[model samples]
Target: MAVGGLDLAKYCSSYDFNSNDVKSCSRAVDLTEACNWQKQRDDLEGVYKSADLHSGICLDPKGKDVGGIDDMLGFCRQKFKRTLDVRASDADGKDWRCVMDIDKDVVCIWQYSDKSLTAVQENGLWVCRRPADAASP
Candidate 1:
């Protein structure tokens, strides 16, 4: 499935992820698709719009980097759960809010609109800074 301008499975394979794990994440991504993959919308609607209403899931491989699409796909394959509304940030203090729970204590997907980057939170660290240079949050 594709979201945020990325084809989840394709991205993972392009990075040479494990075949089994890729399939796993593909399944997870499929589930997420059933519920509609994440999109940075301006409207604050639905349960996901509010972090308080969301829950989390467990991640596989225990401590994978989760800083890239491959790692995210690997993490998602283990469990498909809703993202928690954890207030996360980046080094520059940009609001990189947690958008999805790839896995527990593994990796979390974060969106920093103000910074124009989609970062990955691994053990509280933000990785994969993309869409560089933003003008708003």
Candidate 2:
């Protein structure tokens, strides 16, 4: 399933998602093929969005359901320390948001325009600068 331009590869891989029912229901089942999978996907994206919403504000990770920007920066710095420089970065200010896009693409602080900096999930990396008006809350 696709939504908000996201293929949701990892999400579609496992049927044990929080509320996604990955059943094709081919042979015999409900007439239509629709369930909470869509909802689960949305929920997961919400979590990532929450992280972006609080980026550069909260140093520690936010709620289990959500997280702040520092947490993601730390992930790139600590977990991928060896390749930290190759990864994206942001200034220590507000208005900068970074979230794994709907397609699992790395989207960082860019212009307010619809076209933002989004790197392909498979290759390349995403690095963006703080927007002109993205200096503070």
Whole-model lDDT per candidate: 0.28, 0.27
lDDT for model 2 comes to 0.27
The local lDDT score (0 to 100) that residue 115 gets in candidate 1 is 33
How many clashes (backbone N, Cα, C below 3 Å) per candidate?
2, 1
Put down candidate 2 lDDT per residue, 31-131, tens digits, no spaces: 01111122222222222243443422221223333322333443333333333232223333332212221223332222222343342323333233333
Residue-by-residue lDDT tens digits, candidate 1, 1-137: 11133234443333333222211222223222212223222222222222322322222244322121223333343333332322221222321222231321121132222234454445644354444443334
Pick by TM-score: which candidate is best?
Answer: 2
Worst 10 contiguous positions by lDDT, candidate 1: 99-108
> Residue 104, candidate 1: how far off, in angstroms?
14
What's the lDDT for residue 87 in model 1? Answer: 20
Segments in model 2 whose C-alpha atoms lie over 4 Å from true places:
1-69, 89-137
